[model samples]
Target: MPSAQDIASKLAYITGQLTAGGTNAQMKAWYDEYKKLNVELKEAKAMQKKNPKDPNDLQDPKDLNDPKDPKAT
Candidate 1:
């Protein structure tokens, strides 16, 4: 099975081919593959989000830099 990046690359390539006047058969094939890959990528992302490896991996509110702070200068 191809990784998400690989699938994305293939989808991009197919899009370029279609834009360059690819045949109908090629367009159909690529559209199906693109849909499959898009779903797979979304599912993978959802799973990853559900079970992150590190608790601290989440965004931290303190990480934001306040622009109005006098000491920011």
Candidate 2:
């Protein structure tokens, strides 16, 4: 599986392709992948929100990587 950055970058690429008039088959494939990434992103965000290490204060992701994050560091 690709990293989150990989997935995100590809999603962006696909979005551009769609806007630039890619074939229907290609558009459909990319859109499906984009939707999958959206799901993963949503799950990662939800986990972070629900199980924050510090409810009152949160550290930047660079300083602290939450284990619950689905996006592998």
Candidate 3:
């Protein structure tokens, strides 16, 4: 049960790894792994709808607010 922050962190980590230079084969492997993680994060987020949050639950952080957001950059 990953929180939104956890998903964001994972996305950032993988993005950094891909941008960091690597051999073609190594990049391919990272890409494949990244894809898997992307799917997992999506699934985890979808589950959030089913398990209603408690009244005290924290709100999700908007990626758009990030200064380094891809669209912003």
Candidate 4:
């Protein structure tokens, strides 16, 4: 189970790679992990509805298409 920080880090890295024109293989690998983690995070959140300190609660939902993100720059 990835913590919010871990997810954030992965997302930032993937966004950076995309912005930098990563190779297709690298992009595919990152995308696979990202999708898997996202599903896990959603499930975890649903199961732990009462936790104010839930991991996913710490970060805003990532917008992969957002150009304002630092990694996108």
Candidate 5:
């Protein structure tokens, strides 16, 4: 899977091509790619939000650090 930044760059390039004008076939292809990248970017964002990169952002409910865990020291 491409990173969000890479997707964004591709989307920008597509937008530029669309704005510059092209044959109907070329325009259609670029437009399709743009839509696909848009969807991928959204999915990438959702995944990033669901899984944070920072270790501190993660929590294990069963870990000994949990105050409510009976086995916690």
Candidate 6:
């Protein structure tokens, strides 16, 4: 699976090609690749958000500072 950045770069290139115009078949191929890369980029971003690299970046679901938390006292 390509990283989000890689997918984004490919999508940008495809967009440029699409805007530049081409034969029907060529345009269709580029459009298809663009769509595929867009989907991959979304998925990669979602995965990246779901699994951050740094453990410290994750937040506890139940705040220890909440008054309701027994340890809050």
Instruction: For each of the candidates, give the backbone clash count.
Output: 0, 0, 0, 0, 0, 0
lDDT of 6 by residue, 1-73 (tens): 6667778898999999999999999999999999988889999889878886633333455433677768778
lDDT of each residue in 42-64, candidate 3, tens digit only: 88677666664633236745422
Angstrom error of the Cα, residue 60, model 2: value is 2.3
TM-score of each: 0.53, 0.52, 0.60, 0.48, 0.70, 0.70
Question: On TM-score, who's better, 1 or 5?
Answer: 5
For candidate 4, which ten residues in a row score worst on lDDT? 56-65
lDDT (Cα) of model 4: 0.66
Note the Cα lDDT for every prediction shown: 0.66, 0.67, 0.72, 0.66, 0.80, 0.81
* Candidate 5 residue pairs that clash: none
Model 5: per-residue Cα lDDT over 25-64, one tens digit each: 9999999998999999999778778875734333344332
Whose lDDT is higher: candidate 5's or candidate 6's?
6
Q: What lDDT does candidate 2 reach at residue 61?
A: 57
Q: Candidate 2, residues 1-73: lDDT per residue as tens digits?
A: 4444555677788678778877789889878877887887666556657766634324555556668888857
What's model 2's TM-score?
Answer: 0.52
Model 2, position 14, has a per-residue lDDT of: 69
Runs off by more than 4 Å, candidate 1? 1-7, 54-73
Model 5: how far residue 59 lies from native, Å: 21
CA lDDT of 66 in candidate 5? Answer: 68
**Candidate 1 C-alpha lDDT tens digits along 13-52:** 7677767766788888877877887887777566557865
Assess the local accuracy of residue 72 in candidate 6 as a C-alpha lDDT between 0 and 100.
79
In model 5, the runs with Cα more than 4 Å from the true position are 54-73
Q: What is the lDDT of residue 28 in candidate 5?
A: 97
Runs of candidate 3 exceeding 4 Å displacement: 54-73
